[model samples]
Target: MSTHPTTARPMDGTARAAELTARTAAGAAELTRRTGTAPCLATVLVGEDPASVTYVRMKVRRCELNGIRSRQVVLPAGTTTDRLVEVVSGLSADPEVHGILLQHPVGAHIDERAAFEAIAPGKDVDGVTMHSFAAMGFGLPGFVSCTPGGIMRLLDAYGVDPAGRHAVVVGRSAILGRPAGMLLLARDATVTYCHSRTVDLPARVAEADIVVAAVGRPELIRGEWIKPGAVVVDAGYNPGNVGDVDFAGAAARASLITPVPGGVGPMTVAVLLEQTVRAAAVQLGEDPAALGL
Candidate 1:
């Protein structure tokens, strides 16, 4: 007999993503009507990591769906950190580029944080920089890391109030994991941070009213560790389209759980587009609705 992971409800990210995409498409259409040029997102990818390539492509495809044009820059494996920084700085200075998404984990030798900092905060639509992180933590006016932002939106849409809830976030990556915990904490969720060195990871997870599995390791979170009636948000995008949690098992016990491919993935691009239009409007010091106004 096969044992299944326990979960209460399966979170349907694909359906929710579709709704957001439809809304973004309409927003893009309006932006195009007002501004001569369609909202454009500049994407830069370094090296030849298959996952990064695929992710960039996915983001670009979603941009098209939302009527946003994308400008792609594919760099070679031997590209130096200074060269990468120069490229990003140029994008930050570009007037027509409203948003920028730097495909991360360039390489062990590449200075990713330096590259992220090169992007102007206003144009950092992907929210991968320390500036963006602090802004989101302070609840200030800045773009959020798309996947984390999407998860927060999902919670709101499902009416899963985070106030006073025990939220245990696993992982500490700057982009997804760290921001996810910060976002939850900001919502008054009483969050706990867990990483590779975290002791009794299972116990911590079992105590969670809300679980955010963002560690890149596939199936790192076991289903039996989840507390009953808890909501599970998986922000992982591991290779082979696997999530950090065991969805099959977790869904058996979770009140809601996001699927691997369709769950947090599509929402990332949606939030990116949402912020891209805002960035474009801000650059011109004009109201976003003024386009529609």
Candidate 2:
């Protein structure tokens, strides 16, 4: 392995996210001017987990910054799966709502998939439904899970081509890991998924040209495993703001790496706002690209 001190360049997501958000804000402003309807995102939080609450608050704040309206529905912890579905379905049917986000990890008794499926496909800007997953996998036009979608955008911003590259994604959760791998695969990257059960995880990771750490285990992917000149996208956000990859260690070998807080996090909200604007434009029969989105 080439051991020259990693010429790793920081992929400054904060700067890129700000640029995208500004673009989205401009598009939203134009759309509102033409249609007299501001783009709106409806957020449904099932319980009051502190982290989830904080995340929702951040999203709402970003919406405000982008000139988008936000509608919040806070449900009790004791809410049943059926009731949760009812609530989300109501938001899905609301004509004024352009995008729907259901905060994840609802009560254990609630059927998460059932609740996610209740969202209308058009309003599934969070990309939790089967339709959205299929759309992303097939490279069709549809909303994507914010984090994965944001990762793709980050790659685009940095001009990293996924075509014919080996990408190893750690973790297989529906929202982050699985979709991330699918999205990379759709872009023609050879993809492999490693979870807690995978054998010889380090060896598998060392073979990758691109590594996406989304397993949510802090420092689970050690620095030694990072290939020289690889691009590392650490998508994990654990307690204490730690990511799955050892930042310092991985950076020593990576050509590009994303920092935990400033990396994938900001991009997620930016993509959500951008997609909400697109959804609104579609609903209004306006071309989002023509609005310079």
Query: What RMSD, rounded to one decimal, does every model reach?
Result: 3.3, 1.2
lDDT on C-alpha atoms for all candidate structures: 0.85, 0.93
Cα deviation at 49, candidate 1, in Å, is: 1.9
On lDDT, the leading prediction is 2
How far off is residue 199 in model 2, in Å?
A: 0.6
Weakest ten-residue segment in model 1 by summed lDDT: 1-10
The whole-model C-alpha lDDT of candidate 2 against the native structure comes to 0.93
Question: Tens-digit lDDT track for model 1 on 180-281?
Answer: 988988899899999999999999999999999888899999988988778989887776888899877788888888888878776777788888877877
Candidate 1 wrong stretches, greater than 4 Å = 1-7, 289-293
Encode model 2's per-residue lDDT on 1-293: one tens digit a residue: 24455768889899999999999999999999999999999999987999899989999999998889999999999999989999999988899999999999888999999999999998888888999999988999999999999999999999999999999999999999999999999999999999999999999999999999999899999999998989999999888989999999999899999998899989998999998999999988999999997
208, model 2: CA deviation in Å?
Answer: 0.5
